[model samples]
Target chain A: MNKKYYRWLILILALLVLTFGAGIISLLSGEMDIPWHTLPDILVQKEGIQYSIVTQIRWPRIVLAFSVGGALSLTGAILQGIYRNPLVEPYTLGISGGAALGIALVVVLGLHLSMGSYMLPLAGFIGSIVTIFLVYTLSFRRGGININRMLLIGVMISFVASSMMMFLMAITSSENLHGIVFWMMGSLDEPNALLIDIMLYASLAGLFISYLFARPLNALRLGEEKARHLGIHSTITLRILFVVASLLTGICVAVTGIIGFVGLIIPHIVRLVIGSDYRILLISSFLGGSFFLIVSDIIARTVIAPNELPIGVITGLAGGLIFIVVLTRANVQSKIS
Target chain B: MAVYLNIQQLVCGYNLGFQLKGIDLKIEKGAFAGIIGPNGSGKSTLFKAISGDLNIQSGLIEMNNKKLSSFSLREKALKMAVVSQFNEVLDVTVEDYVLMGRMPYRRNFQFFETKEDLIIARKYMRLTNVYQYKDHLMTELSGGEQQLAAIARALTQEPELLLLDEPTAHLDISHQVQILNLIQHLNEEMGLTVLIIIHDLNMAGEYCNHLVMMNDGNIHQHGNPHEVLTYQNIETVYNTVVIVRENPVSGKPVVFPVSEKTFKKTTNTSS
Candidate 1:
């Protein structure tokens, strides 16, 4: 193989190894001290307290982290591609505010108490889809989605949603208020097997669909007019990607409240390493994001042992640092170009 | 033979701010035409209308005797390719960028480009003389080289009607000539119909057989360069004094602006 292919191969292999190593570390280093020597037997035989801790508790968290991180990054990649703007991310279009409002309604109305654990996520998912659909419909002008208008509308809707959520919070009992605030701050505390499985499958489906549109997404990065000239149906492509991004973002936010920067920064990091070909960019981003969140979650767990920090805090701090570095480097590169 | 492109009473604009009003023009098969005018003369707007990028308010654009709007965007793309000013610095490889031109031919949902697509991309890259930089990132090339790569990408579309908007605006003298000459050679040898918008009248005169001088969203004059590039025609439309003379080498019209000092000196010499 030529140099480029060889380098890509090496990079993929290295990422796979790192992801595997990180998964093992995550599985072993949780609160319950499962002996490292018996870890293989625990995984295979699936018995005893250690196995239960590893399988029922740690495994779901780890898998959920991977799925959520992968979904967010893939969402970011697609949004950036469709917008032709690198700064865009999953929540940039107001999905977070919408999902938060959904949960707020559920909590304030005491619906979750009656309907059980699935109610919050279901409501959040519905709210997100509705909000996205509304924003999309509002932005449609002359048979095309005006991106600038769409962004503005999304921001406006976000403000409205947040204010409504605050209203709901104000009228709620102190007990429900505390619960609402914690969920809004974002968490991965509860690991539901069914929800994680759904999100995992949804993220994989989103990734597959994104891969199928890779060529057109590549064309889209050149700009809409050019992509249209190339016969890529720029409008249809943008709409499809918008739906996919919204679904992925909705599902992620529904399960784990707004983990901010996995979507924003992971794609940028992947692009920096792998270059801008969407075919490779999407796959690498999924892997890179999975690895990043696994490591970040590990840090979140072990930093103040027995009492874990929210994963968002870690990702936000690291994402902020990375953003500054990326901004500066982009400035320097722009000047050079 | 049928007219390859026909635009009649075309009026288009972006929400009442700026408009191309009642512009009419036509291009015959295997002919090179240049659209020239002062800034804001609706030249680019006319190109947009023809390319179906702008929605026509009230007008008719026909390609191959069919309404331009009748064809799908892909059909339009397969018929005509445009090379406009690409100001953004795209982070794509030269070869991959060129491969975008073959997008019209590929089926929807087809991700991988075929061998034939690669061959066509390489063919155009070689034609535009940017084949050596096929693997190089677009950012790594100079502005002139990038412009050539853009042209190569346009050529890869295999268009019958090639439209260019100020393609040589940012190139050096040598690069400008090199680009114009390449475009000229393509029109002549490949029998491609060319409609180029150029601010430089001299280059337009040299490369384009016909000229369409636009003024205030309308065609001011349209004919051979010798007829449209006259001093009276340019002075009236552009509101500037210029000396129009023939190039001794090619016997084509060359326009030179008559600045105050140069006009005085030239008058003194002539008297």
Candidate 2:
């Protein structure tokens, strides 16, 4: 194999291993003290006394970490492809704001819905669809989408959404306000297997659709004009990717309430490690994102020990640092060239 | 020959605060047409209008007997490939960049490039003589090499009509000559209808099948190189006097600068 190919293979394997190790550590953690020996027994569904500790709390949370991390990173990767800008992430489109608003409205208003979790996520998904549709419609004309304009609209909407959340928080009771604010900050404190399963399934669908256009993303890196000459329908490709990725971001936001940076930082890191080929970038992004989130969640769980830091906080700080490093590296690369 | 492109009273320009005007012109198929005018003469603007990059303000643009507005964007793209002014791209490999020419050909859910796509990219790269640079980074290539690569990228489109807007702008003299020569070869050898907006009048005079000397958004004089490139026409269009002579080698009209006073010495220098 070529040297580049070998390096990419080694990096992917290492990341995969690292992520697996982190998941195991997460599965074994907390005060419940599930015996490590019976962990495998619990996994296979042959009962054990510690099954509740292993399955009820630890497993669900761990699964949540993986799905959220994977979904965010994959969304980030696909968004970068669609926008054709490495600096732009999933939230860069402003769909996350729509998701945030959906969650906040349900929580702050104290809607006595029977299935709040499902309703919140569904609201988020619909919000994303509407936001992306608005952005597309506003920016598109004469068969072209102006990316800078679209991104500007997204940023403005996010700011507006953030203020709306703050307003709701200011007016609500302190008890409910705390939960809403924390949810907006992003967390995995409340995990149910059904939510994980639903998100995992949704993520799988988004990723499969994204995978269907790996080569087109590669082509898109050259910009839409050239892509059109190559016989790609630029508008159709952009629309499909935006809608699908928004859906993924929506589900994630609805489930976790604005977990920042997973979709922002992971794809660029993966691209720098591997080459910019869309096939490899997309796959590695999913794995790398899953691994990063898993590790971040681990840090979130263990660092304070008795008190956990929000997963969003950990990811945001870490992702911000990584983004700076990437910026510098890109600067140096351009300088050298 | 087929009526490949016909622009009747075609007004092409941007809507900059006020209005953009249209001008009349008709272009036949298989012609090595050149649009030449001084800077700000709307030469590139006209090209943009015909290529569907800019919508017409008023006049009509037709291709193959159909109105330009009538053709779908993809259909227009399939028929015309434009090698626009230099593009700013970073870290893209030449092969991958060239393969972008195949994007319009993909089904919605296609996640991979087929072997046939690679073959087509290679063929165009080879034709433009930039095949060796296929794996080189776009930022790494020299100006002339990049320009050739850009042409190769357009060639990958395999369009019936090739439109280039100041394609040789950044190249050095030898490379500029090389690029122009390549375009000339593509025109004559393949019988492709070539429309280029070149600044160098000498190059335009040398290669064009039909020269459109546009001044103030209108063709001042357009016909054979011999008929259009006269001392009077040059004087009227550019407000400068020049010596017009036959290029001894190609027998084409060649314009030389009159640095010293030539009005009194015109008769003496004619021989």
Among these predicted structures, which one has the highest DockQ? Answer: 1
Across B1-271, the per-residue lDDT of candidate 1 in tens digits comes to: 4588888888898886789878787899888999999898888888888877888999899888999888888898898898887645677779988988998998867766788988999998998999999988888889999999999888999999999989999789999999998998999999999999998999989889989999988899999999999999999999999989999999999998989888889889999
Give per-residue CA lDDT, model 1, range A278-325, as digits (tens). Answer: 878898888888888888888888889898998999999987897678
Model 2 per-residue lDDT at A17: 92
- DockQ of all models, two decimals each: 0.57, 0.33
Candidate 2 chain A lDDT trough over 10 residues, lowest sum? A328-337
For candidate 2, lDDT tens digit of each residue in A1-337?
Answer: 3444576678778878988888887787765545667678787884665677667777778777888888889988887777766677788777877776766677766662566556766776766777777777777766667877777887787787778767877888897777667767888865556778988888878778888777667767767766654445666888888878877887788778778888878887777666577777877888788888888887887788778898988998988997787768754466222
TM-score of each: 0.93, 0.85
Candidate 2: tens digits of C-alpha lDDT, residues B1-271: 6777777777656656322355767777888888887776678678877776666877787887888888776676678888877764646678877876766666667645678878999998998788998877788888788788888878777778899998888778899888888888988888788999988778888888788887877778788788888888887888776879988999888888776456658766786
